[model samples]
Target: MNTWCVAAPLCLSVQSYADGNLTLENKGEDGKGKCPFDPFQRYASVMFENKLYSATSMNFLGSEPVLMRSSPVSIRTEFKSSWLNEPNFVSMAHMSESVMSASGDDDKVYLFFSETAVECDCYNKLLVSRVARVCKGDVGGQRTLQKKWTSFLKARIDCPVLESQLPYIIQDTYRWCDPQQPWKDCLFFAVFTPQSDTSDLSAVCVYLVSDISKVFAEGKYKTPVPVETSFVKWVMYSGDVPFPRPGACIDNSARKAGITQTLDLPDRTLQFIKDKPLMDHAIQPIGEAPLLVRRGAKFTRIIVNQVQAADGEKYHVMFIGTEEGTMLKAVNYNGEMFIIEEVQLFQPPHPIKILKFSNVTRQLYAGSDYGAAQIPLATCGRSSSCMDCVLARDPYCGWDTVGGKCIVISNSQRELIQSVKEGDASLCPGADPVKPVNQSIWLGGNVKLSCPSASNLGKTTWEQDSSPLTLSTHLQLLQDGLLIFNASHSDTGVYRCLSVERSKAGEYTTTLAEYHVSIPEGGDDRNVISPEAQINGPSLAGLQVVVGLLLVSLLALLAWNFYKGHLPLPWNYRKKNREQSQETPDQEGLNSCTTYQDAQRPALAEDKPLVSGIDNGSRNNNHTRGAAAFSAAEENDDSTFTPPSLQYIDDESEM
Candidate 1:
């Protein structure tokens, strides 16, 4: 309904990322032989009659394109027919009832292909598009058309641009049916590009199953007649056709006798196909123009599904595959077409050659040059956040506020839809914060930091300390949002992943994942960090180093103070002048100040004499004293020696 809306992702990221829902595994193998056109152009593959069949080239540009069949138990069957000369097939289908006669001997498999005419070689090489049918029970004709289709008949498919009347060549075709509707109403949608490559115009023509059958019933046959002096002239031949149609699958009516065979058929019924190959009437698209008219990329394959919404209304959802490995989903709503979304399905740019859909699983399988891959038709759960769920205009998914997740809608989706339409975000309390992930690595080593986003619809950039990094070999930002390459301590910083998202509202930027990287100084633990460390956050080796250094400095400070003995007490004295004044000086005298014992600080006390009550002789270098023997105040003997100022001693004694 709206231009491709920008929605939030399950987890906010530069490229919207989540648990990848699309599971891809290589299926079959790389195609060996190319189609009749080119090895690069893959052939048409289809599931017919409960068996897998593909019409592929013998080799790259080799002779007749062979129709190959493979089953679970049987070896591959390569049905070679000389009739299919340089035939480039467009599509295949299993004929519904009524497409065949009552003979009950013809095949239900039908093919639409374009080939050069053998009979009209004299006139010119006419590129004819025809519908061919094969037999189901006929292994090989015993006498006639052995190993070839006996009931093979084809008619022309008329497709032209209505406005310019430019003849468009069929490039791709798809057969679509709705189980809930009548099978007879099914139609074949063929994509066409003008024969002139210079023209940028493309078209889609819808051909009815019944209209194609009319060409076999009563249509003119192109017959060439030789003139006496001129080239052969082409004319429409009119004649009574044979009973069992050449291309019709046999039922159980007049053909029940089982006598009618390709050899038994006369020229009248065979000529029916020749005259009717060119149907002048044109088949048009559902709307005014083609279902889609894109400019650059061509639509390679398409498949349609009837999706029933909650209201019991069914809509035909079309999935169109392009040459750019993109799958575009569209819906025919209210007589208008709306493109729902476009997704990049293939890992490489390979044009989609075949498209198949499963109604049971709602999954689409695309075949290309590389291989076949399956993708879910709906990506509802990819809208995890409430804002994303509301913005993602998907019919099959919605936000489950109670469950705190985006879920595929089945029963409890009505409320989600109503809330989103009403812009009610009350259910979502708040968005979860993107916690900064921590990591530790050694210098000269390498580490990878991934910035996985929920959706891949944004531009990602790596910023260190909020500044863009000029990434080099030493620090690299990979295409997939991985920060890797050689690492060093300088690389450690607050690395953030910023994703830029644009919407009709405007451009919005957000942080995806913040990496707090730390590198250990020493090269001792040379290996990478542990897995547990990754989950619990980066190692605290850097923080531990800082704490260790602080503890060592504290211990050294305590030991240095004990050496000077200044730390025991900020103020200390071995001689107390007050106590010395009370007691007479015994035969021994007191010792001098021991403040300058530490070589770290100059001996300022040496400039002044000792201030003790008993000023005994010059201070002996051998003077020794313990704390238990001295008790005196410097104030008690100020006259004995000019004592250092008490104020100065107080400041100097302060350790």
Candidate 2:
């Protein structure tokens, strides 16, 4: 139901809808059947003074790339391989150069992109990050270039980390400038990735506008030369340079020489620029190296913000977006890049497509294919402890002693403690007491003590009784805890897990966990000691009463048995023994005359075997009995012997 306009590439076509109806429609540029911009290929565009300037492919197949002005109708870059070779445009910046230019040069529009490197020789294709500039006042030449730009020139943006590690693929770039200063003092920050997939390193490099201008204006040009039968190579041209330079803008110096425009330039100058548009000197970064180099993340977008800390020193904080929908906040402290923290901006992690920072709101706007998110630049209230807040070293957060919490620092704030560089927790007014958990374990048993890591940058270690824990066969350190195998009494002590984070200022130690480990005594190896049983002891009077009751029951049973005449008393048993000894051998049979005293005698180790020889001797040496006894002894010698019993009483009178 809303009115809309579609700007297509076919003759700068426009389709307007008003009141749910198509009111106007047109096609092609210059009112002719010619396409000025390709609708299929991705492109980069910028608006300057109500005029649209775009760098995009001109054809459907995206083979022919060009940088064209929309209002001028087909005024674009010349279709030459030297100008742009398979360039994939990323973004564009349009700023005035009148503030710092001494030559009174025209304003310029800079384009950032990655294209196939024609100057480098390799087995496969090599793409390099480039920054190309074109004067805003360029209106094409009269006869030489016709409708093509005469000031179009590009140079490599150098972001070298080491001699061999070169991140040449530019993923994204952002232009940052101080609001109180002129636009000429702006700096361009670019995110570069390595061309090879062997390393996933991403680097952020900053380029000064002056360095880029010098390379285009004063650098040498590379010219093509024949090498072999059909091979040609582009090398640096070391010959007499043409006047006014090939890629210099039409400035006051050109006006003094009676050449006020590109049309006034001779045919020699246009032909020279057509063959050599690439600069020999690459634009190095501010420090001749990358501002930050991270190995595990591939940065997709970046935004920089200038912040004033509590110390009154200004720092530029860079928020870099990764391919995994995470934002990394980093800053260069004393020439060293330190990553403050990483925030996950999306769930189920989509790649971050765009990033925009608002200086007024102090918020970061991130967008992806799924949706967009608005995240605050700092979340200071998440820190629960002063030590944690201080060790974070976040410039936006400070420990508020009066409020007993961490709060955000602003220009108008006061009476807050912050040490962004040192991360010294000693500056804190007071620290929370560390309470140790008491654990009672059995001897010769295994136990694992847990410890949490305070920070990802810190190293965890176990300390015993205020000294470094020594490793032995029984002690083992794990990722999150310590294991004691077959724990002994020697392993019992106070254990503290300390996390130490090292920085340039100093090292900070924080106690993650404290434990008081003790092994209870008086326990067998097979049984665990019971705490309840150890707390309660047995009563001595109870044991004595139970023993007396058992003794009385035995005496009453013995008396009842004697009264019933089933069991003989001690005197009766002695009288029976005497009567048995007084009886003659003829009065009783051999087996019936045996006494109970002989049967009750205990056996001894050295006792001899019982035989019929004693009975034979008692029978007055009878010949028949003696002959039978001799035969029995001979038969018993082949069989097993039964030894006689020998009993010895300690006190015969008591028995």
Candidate 3:
């Protein structure tokens, strides 16, 4: 069995931009210190010119009530107001939201607040709130210090009734004006009817003033000019009139008793009595403080459920912040309203107090309990295909099936393509629109490109310009066709399959299919070490044999020299010196044999052992012995030999 081990190059992909957690501090307010009022209590509204205005209402122990206003971005206070009359201000309820309208001679901002009478008996009774108008002309100098405020021509409607009993009482108000027609200004508010003591029956109400001439008329303040009001109901829950219901009613029985002239039913005034029981669905509550956009006479509702504030320039786009920590977006095309998208703009559980849109950059800003946030309008929208539509830059012209000509998809689709041509002439050229794959594939692999089937048989051709090669095949008419390539370098380019059909009448038709093929650059196989570079196991064993042979040869040479007695020069000289020293004593003792013979003293007492007479045979034996001894001495002398005693001495020294 063969196994292959592969090692691929490592590559680390880098992010296009840095990614980390971002903590942005609150713009103006330091979180460490205590603010005079709850920062969340302030609400923001945007004007047509893109300036942001915030409103705050606080009730102090002082006699006068205080109203505060400032620019959205500035920390410095801009405008302040005290109560008109000095009465111990009981509970002061500032409108949670404000609206800006320009229906009158001057641009006016309508502020809504609820007030209660300071006296004991009236203390428990909640005063109905009214819209207070502040004209643009009245504001002058830096920060517009000189201020004038006027109550709405209508009496203050009971807030509880406006909140619950009356369907038309605005629960929330949004500021809006039409740029094209400034005079046709309008305010949108959410209306709700009180069903139970706790729940609100919701709807949307719009107040519109078509003409401003009456409001601009020259007059002094005798009685406040009553601006004509009209109400439009949207999203009603049941059968309910959009009007305020008051808790008290004065008795007009004296007129009926003939004590005074008969009076009309309070002429242009609506009153409600608490004694009267409410019938089922008696109140029609509209949207609370609804943000509105006026397109001609049609009023577009910009907010949905729980929207605290909304600001929009064109009816086509709107930015709405809800009390549920959510920022919702809706777009109006023609007369239809569609919620495009929504983003969780605030942290969970923090209610969004205000939402303002910038006219300069068209960005939307939201204020919540924590801080403020801004989101680009382009980041939001309805269509998931919008990104692709923008990249195509095709103007998103709707397809014309009948006329075969592409036309813009206006409000009406059919009307746009009426005069365009039809059939195959209108089909998009080139390959089918490319779509992202489920997963990226490795290089040098076959990929299938799908195209719609043709009614007739046609020729399919695949070409890669980088490879300078083309593969063509005749395909039977099929819904989906597949082209194959035995992996080749030339097949790496963008592969396209064109199906061409030639009719018998000489008409040629073609449809295109495209696929992208990539072949990574590098050697296909890995380089491996050659066997020649590795040591052989058998060669190591052979080296051991050669070493053994060399050792044996050296040992034999040493043994041969010892056996021959041809020891080194140092061993030879030591043996010779020992022999000479031993021989000196031996030579002195043995010299008497030669001297006795010369002196003829053989017959002396100690030496006279033998008789004179001897047989010839015995004498011959003696002479033989003497001759042998003499011959051994002469051989030794001629050979330069050491004496026997010297030889014994050398042997002992050697041992």
lDDT, candidate 2, at 354? 86
TM-score, per-candidate, Cα-based? 0.49, 0.69, 0.32
lDDT of each: 0.57, 0.77, 0.35
Task: Sort by TM-score, best first.
Answer: 2, 1, 3
Q: Specify the poorest-scoring 10-residue window by lDDT in model 3.
A: 273-282
Residue runs of model 3 more than 4 Å from their true location after superposition: 1-109, 114-129, 134-172, 186-204, 210-316, 332-336, 380-655
lDDT by residue (1-655, candidate 1, tens digit) is 6785432212111334358654444343334332233545446667766766566665543564666554432222233332465677787787655444343434356677776654453454556555655545434334444444445545556565654443456777777776655555777877766655576765556677656655654455555567786665555555554565544544465355554444444455444433333333333444435665556567777777665653456666778888788888776545445566688778868888778887688678998878888988777767657655544444565677678777666657445541322323343456777799888766566688888663444578889888997878677668666655666667888888877644334554557788988865554355755443556555587668889999999999999988888666534443454455665443113333333233312443453333333325433421332121122333355423333333222333222
Candidate 3 structure quality by residue, lDDT tens digits, 149-220: 121221232223333442223335454444444434433333222324354233334444332212322111
Deviation (Å) of 139 in candidate 1? 7.7
For residue 476, model 2's alpha carbon misses the true position, in angstroms, by 8.6
Top-TM-score structure, candidate number? 2
